[model samples]
Target chain A: MPKLSYLKALHRALRDEMDRDESVFVLGEDMNFALTNTTSGFLDRFGADRVLEMPLSEQGFTNFATGAALAGRRPVVEFQIPFLLLLVFEQITNQANKFLLMSGGQRSVPVTYLMPAGGHRPGWGAQHSDQPYSLFAHMGVKTVLPATPTDAYGLLTTAIRDDDPVVVIGPLACLGVREDVDHADLVPVPLGKGRIHRAGTDVTLVATGHLVHEAIAVADDLAGDISVEVFDPRTVYPFDWDLLAESVGRTGRLVVADDTNRFSGLGAEVLATAAEELPLRVPPKRVSRPDGAVVGAAPELDAVLQPTREQIADAVRSVLKESGWGA
Target chain B: MSVLDEVPATEADSAVPDSAALYRTIRFIRRFEERAVELVKAGEIRSGIHPCIGQEAVAAGAVATLDADDVVLSSHRGHGHLLAKGCDPARLMAELAGRATGIDRGRGGSFHPSDFSANVFNATGTVGHGAAIAAGIGWAAATAGSPRVVLSFFGDGAVSQGALLEGFNLAALWRLPVVYVCENNGYATTLPAGAAIAGTVVGRGEAFGIPSSSVDGQDAETVYAAVREAVVRARSGGGPSLLEMRTYRYHGHHTFELKTRLRYREQSEVDSWLGRDPLLIQAARVAEDERARVDAEVEARLDEVVRFAVASPYPDPATATDHLHADGLRPRPGSAR
Candidate 1:
């Protein structure tokens, strides 16, 4: 079996889709040079026509992708930074997303907005570090944040093939993560399906994107004293609530580790949903950044703002204590 | 190809700009808008429309230059644009009436209707965003080796929007087959164009290296001649051209103005624009008998349009979410739990 890195998985997905469908092409800044590495070797393999280099006009090119999609072409647009997503938010949400409904289903905008370096990078400051996947999910856009290399490969492929516009956020923290996999086993991961990384009876730790790795580590660290189930909801918008319910039902305990801000974040939603529907023996806990958090210049300050494995372990312990198991 | 080569000498091609046809189009738009206004007053149409009564010639002339296969991205005030592009007036009227038989199944209403079957891709409520979308469509068509040119229509207000200018840059850089038509109606709602836009409308296109020009938007013949040249340039891979049509709106921005009586422009200014009415200008070019026939024909057609709109049923509330997603995935029912 070959080792596949998360970034390489993204590259493989783009290469494979372009080979499979002639209509699939990429347009973004520095695509020719593959500045993001997800588009690495794409220019040579797919030619300049398909791997287009765009000027620094995010709004212009964003809507351009929508127009191309309307004309029966699948365009994968790569954004270098997370804030660019905010810049073109209206172009994607108001223009691209609204077209299908506004046209009365006469057309579909099959454009993929790929954020290769989404979420925090050490000293990248406030603008560069944002996990805004929850924003898209709230807006009803199909949003995916794959936690593993294989899941990255699968979700990116699925986003391209999907008829409606989708936003695929490739967490910067997960880009270096690698896994052993057979190339033949790489397949499309359906949106809205949750993957239980590890099954346990004590507590269910629901995670997203790079946070799944943190949850798995916490689960391993607490293995002697507690059993933990790691549930990864690969797609955030069409969430696998059924699977989540089943997991929480068995464990009767829930803790969510999300990278986004605490207020109205994915973690909050998971806790709310589980509390409302699932049978929880203990009160749910959430490990997430504080309200309106911005990772500052200092490494120490930035370290505390992001959800850490220690925080997840603490949240688990708190839930256990609340259920009188740790007494 | 030279400008002369752009206009085919074939009789069918020449007849497209025939005097009577232009008159009928302008007359139809004029009467249709008047009838729609009456419907608005009668409460048949819920929202008051942004009538393009004075600027009918711009749409009629520019759309006539396009082939049936060509696509158009229109603005909020797009009823005339759709009619000129060959949309069924009855269906459009029904759309205004929020009827199930409307072009958008009554989902889009007056502000955001789209008639894909007529190649009128969409009418965006966002002022200048359509320009970027149009450029994308043009790029797609060019990449596919199709000669189809895309026309993006906006008002003078859109000239100042940064996104629209960004679109101009891309269109010029890629030589995308697009014609950006800016109808300078001298007002952006209550604000005058001079107060809102700096430099000039065509200057924005010129700064982007697009071949920009000004045309008489009041005359259908002049507008046709100017837009025909731009369409030719685009089809022959000359990239995009920006044409600033100096026109005006005879009515208020929306029908609500009929009650509010906002005084932005003087009544004299309104009278002056009305003097250059597109319907009257095109009517003069046709014979008196022909004009009368077109008038009577348009009157009868509008009667049928209104009748159809009034008789059409409203869409069932259960189907309100029908076209929300292409995958037909309805939203999950609310959970009390």
Candidate 2:
């Protein structure tokens, strides 16, 4: 079994897809130079025609990818900075996302907006730190936030091949996480499917993106008193609520860990939907950054702004206590 | 059926538009816009259209030079572009009327209709954004080893958008087969070009090292010659070119202006542009018998077009949000389920 890090998984998925489909081309700033290491050595392998190096024109290139996709060429656009997504949100959300509907399904834009260092890298201030998968998801764009190496490779591979626009966010924090992998186990993960990493009869901890790792660790630490189930809904939009309902029904408790703003974030949507539709013994709990959070430059500030494992552990016990069950 | 004059196989593949066929195209767009305006007033067209009434030659002349298979990216005032590019008049009228028989199946109204048969990929209402999409299509065609050139049409206002200039840079850098036509129609909504643009229009294209020229948009032949040269250059892998068409619209920016009664341009300035009307300019070039025949035929054809548009059924409400995703994922209902 080879140890596959999350970064390698993302890089490998892009390399493999381009190899599989000649129509799959990459365009972004400094792609030939491999600024994000995702397209490292791509220029030499695919030649200058396939790997396009764009100028520092985000909006132009974003819509350019949309146009290319309209002409039957699959474009995987990689943006190094997460905030650049905000800059070109209109191109993705308004243009590429709506083309299929607006064109009456006559044309489909199969462009993959790949954000390599999504959400808060170390020392990068407020401008660069944002996990905006919720933004794309809200606009009905298929959004993928993978928590593990295998899931990263699977989900991203699926995104590039999709006939519509998809946003694949490789969370900066999950890049270093590694796992032993059997190459046969590496496969395309279907969107809107939840993976139950650990099963239990007690509370169900539904975590998103990089926070899924923190959630699993918290479940292990509280193994003595509470039986916790850790579930990761890798793709946020078109969420697998049926899978979520079954887990919550078994546990009779629900808690969400998310790496976004407290208000209207992924965690809020999970709890809101569960509270409105799913069976729950007690009120659902959510651990997320404060409302409209702006992560500062310092590491301590980043940690303070991020959801922690201790917070997830406490939320699980508190939900049980609220239910008047043994905490 | 297509009411507009579609060139014959011989003329379609010709390097330039035949004078008579070109006159019919300009005349067709002129009559089509007039009928659309009437439909807007009759309450059939819920969203009043942007009438490119006087700027017909730019669409007719420019589109005449290209092959029927080449792609086009249009703007908000795009009926002229679409009609000249060979979209069925009845379907286009139905699209304006928000009918199920529209080119976009009523998903996109007059503002965003895309006719794949005509090679007119959907119009972007956002100003200047179509340029980038055109460049992208151009790049894709070149990459696929296809000789298809892309034509992007926009107004004077689009020149200032950062994305449009960036689009220029990309097309010039990659030597993509795209022709950008700027209809400098004196004003954008209400602001005059003198107040809106900083430097000259051709300078924007020249700054990117693209072959840039300004043409008299009122004469159909002048526009045809300029676009034909650009198309020839693009088809031969000579990169992109920009042509600034000095044209003016006879009507207000949109039909909404009919109610607002806004007074921006002087009456004298309005009368001056009306004198050089592109339709009349081309009408003179054709034989009197031919011109009168096209006129009678176009008016009679538009009557049926209007009937088809108003009589077409509206789409079912159940499918209002259909075709949103390729994978067929539905959003949760708005009300409590």
Candidate 3:
């Protein structure tokens, strides 16, 4: 067994894919120096041709990756900050994503947009902190946010091999998380599959990215009184709605903890889907950042804006109490 | 049948830049556009097109320099580019009519039609974004050890876009084999270039250290000579080059201007540009008998193109989600169940 940190898993996935496929290359700013740590040591191994260091031109390089994909090369574009995704939204969604349909399936843009540190990090103020995976999911782009090291390795490997545009977000908080793993067991994870961390019958707690760890910890703390089910959807766009419905059907309650803004967030969509389609004994609840949340530079302000384990536990208890099944 | 497969071996391998061929190409595009406008009036082609009536030489002459294997990224006014690149007229017309037999299967209408079979990768409606994509394609070709040079065509309006400039920087920095062609038709939709652009079109290229020059876009030979030199440079690994083709459009930006009178340019200005029509300019170089014969041939070809486009069938509504994903993954049915 080997201990694999989340960041190390992403680095390994990229390095292995490049080794496996010559067409797979990395293009981004500061990739030569590996400023984000995921692309570290790639420049020396792949050389300047395969590991390209682009200028500070987000939109240009984004569309450039699309062009490369059109020419039968798979490109993985790494962005340093999460909001950089917002800068090239039109390039990805409008141009790259629509090429397959616009060309009448004549072309497939196999470009992966990887955000190394996706969510809020203390001291990195408003401009850099944003979790925009929901935006990509809404635009029908395959969006993945991995919660664990093994899942990160699997999803990123799958994203690089996919024939369409995919956005892989490595939440800032999950980068340091590590787990013991058998190296031989590492494999590609299929998209749209939800992983159940812990099974219970009283309530279903749906979490994404970093929040999955929080949900699991809260479930352990409340084991004496309540029975909680923790579900982590690795990919958000082609969401595992079937698995979600099945879980909620058994638990009879739903609560979502997401890091995205409260308005039009993934949590909102999850709660809405559960209420409209799934059979639930009580109303579903969501714990998310306030509407139009701008994380400040201070640690306390950032902490207050982020969804905490206490918030998840509180939401879970409220749902249980509403269903009149509280211990 | 694929249009590229039907192309003559010699025609696909090399473009001789002869007078008759250039004249026929210009005339074919000019009449094709006129007939397309007529189709628009008849309510067959849904939207009005950006007619490249006077700017045919830029498309005909520039495309004449490239081999069939080379790629082209075109702009909104791209019918001439497609036709000159050897795209079948019937399929192009079908696409404009939104028929199932279109080059893009009617998925992309007038603004965005792509025919990968012809090596015309795509014609984006977005003004300037294609340049970056073109650079990427060039970079990919270089990496693959292919001797393919990508030509990116855009309006003078695209010179000011930050993305296009960034593309220039990347292409020059990496020495990617791409030719950036700017057709300065003096106006972008309605705004004049003088008002929109800051320094100059060629200056934008020079600032990026890319070898650039301005050429008379009205004359087919001049445009051919300039673009041919750029293409040669790119193929020889000399890096990217920019050519500013000073041209004009005889008609309004779109066919809707036929009914709505948005007075931006003087009628005299229009008359002056119409006088420099690429079709007539090339028509003068050929004998009267040859010109008349070419005119008759173009007319007959366009007649067939129109008939074929109108006779094609529209796609079924049940299959509207087709081609949305490469893996044929359709969206969930209307109901949640």
Candidate 4:
């Protein structure tokens, strides 16, 4: 078994895909030096044509990738975040995403938007931090946020292969995650599937992105005292609702830990869906940022704004308390 | 080997359609637009379309330079573009009528439609965005060593859009084989081009280091000649070129204007443009009898087109969410799975 880091998994998946498919090419800003390290050695291996270094014009390049995809090529665009994905929000959401439906299925825009620096950056100002995966999902653009190294590699591979516009958000929080795995087992993970890290009889805890690892830790910390099931919906858009239904069915208690804002965020969607469909014994609790939150520059303020493990644990306990179940 | 030597400019003109063929296209576009407008009046096309009545030459001329393999990205006022690019008139009419037999499954009624079958890749509803989209297609073709030139058609209004200029930059930088034809219809919806765009239309391209020029958009041959040279340059690996065609739309910006009577453009200005009508200019080249024959043929075909469009079935409401994904992934409904 070999240890693979999350960043490496992303890099490996990109290199492998480009190697496998001649039509697949990388387009984005600052790829010559691989400033993001996602396409570290791509310029040499893939050549300038395949690993293109686009100008700083994000909107122009985003739509350009759409055109490339429309012309029968799969363009994996690297959007340097802080606001790269946000800048081309229309290009992806309005233009690229709608190409297939608007074309009446005559064409497909398989342009994968990879945001390596998505989610909150510690002590960074609002400018350098924002998670727009929910935005893409809301716009019906296929969005994925892999929580670990293996999931990162597998999900990214699948995203490239998908014949629709997909936004792969590699959140900074989960970038440091590493796991020991057999190389052969690193395979494509299907979109709209969930990986339940730990199963518990008491409550189903749904988490996404970096919050998944945080959720698993809290579930472990509360092991003997409380039973908690940590479920990671790898592909956020075509969510693994069936799996969530099964988990919540057994526990009858639910808690969601999402890194985005509480108002109209991923957490809100999960809570809403659970309320509508799930057979819940207790009122579900969700750990998420306040309405329209921006992680402040100060480290402490940033830490406080984030959904910590304590909040997840407290949310689980609160749901149990509401049901009159022993904590 | 130089790609220029391989595909010379002189050799490109050998494929340019004869004068009779050009007149037929202009006449066909004029008739198609008039018929489409009638369908709009009949309420077959729920949302009234942006009628490209007066500006037929721009589409006819620019598209004629393109080979069957070349692709085009069109704007909102793009029925003429689709027709000139060889889209089946029946299917296009069906598309406008919101029928299942339409080119886009009736999903793209008027604003956004892409007929890959006709090499018309897309018609973006968002103004000016088609420029960058076309640039992308050109980049892909050049990268693959394919000699396919991409033609992007936009209104003078698009010249002011930052995204459009950004598209110009990429096309110029990569020298990606693309022909950017700006149909300067002198108005962006209602606002005069003079008021909407600062500097000039061709200047926008020149600022981007693109080989930019202006042509008489009303004359099919002039439009053809200018775009033909640019197309040859593109096929020979010469970067993108921007040709601002001086043209106009006779009807209101859209059918909505028909009832509203926006009164934006002066009647005198309208009368002036109507004087140099593209149909008359192209018809002059062909004999009167031949022109009359084309006119009759066009009317007969349009009659069948309208009939076929009316006969075609509208898509089932249940499949409204279909084609959202190319793989046909049925999204779980908003309610629940």
- Local distance difference test, per candidate? 0.89, 0.90, 0.90, 0.88
Better of 1 and 2 by DockQ: 2
The DockQ scores of all candidates, in the order shown, are: 0.77, 0.85, 0.79, 0.84
Residue A32 error, candidate 2, Å: 2.1
TM-score of candidate 3 to 2 decimals: 0.97
Report the candidate with higher DockQ, 3 versus 4: 4
Taking every candidate in turn, the Cα RMSD to the unseen true structure, in Å, is 3.4, 1.6, 2.0, 3.7
Per-residue error (Å), model 3, residue B136: 0.5
lDDT of 4 by residue, B17-87 (tens): 45777788788888888888889999999878999999988888787777878998899999988987778
User: Proportion of native contacts in model 3?
Assistant: 0.76
> Which candidate leads in DockQ?
2
Q: How would you class the docking of model 2?
A: high
lDDT of 3 by residue, A10-93 (tens): 999999999999999999998878999998899889999999899999999998998999999999999999999999999999
**Model 1 residue A152 distance off true place after TM-score fit, in angstroms:** 0.6
Of candidates 3 and 2, the better by TM-score:
2
lDDT of 1 by residue, B1-337 (tens): 1111222334124534766777787888888999999999999999889999999999988888888789999888999999988788999999998999998888778898888877888888889988989998999999899999999999999988989998999999999999999999999999999999889998999998999999999999899888888998999999999999999999899999999999999989899888998888998899999888878978888888899999999999888778767788666656663
Off by over 4 Å in 3: A324-327, B1-16, B333-337
Pick by lDDT: 2 or 4, better one = 2
lDDT of 1 at A219: 93
lDDT of 2 by residue, A96-186 (tens): 9888888887888999999988987767878989888888878888999999999999999999999989999999989999999997888
Model 4 gets an lDDT of 0.88
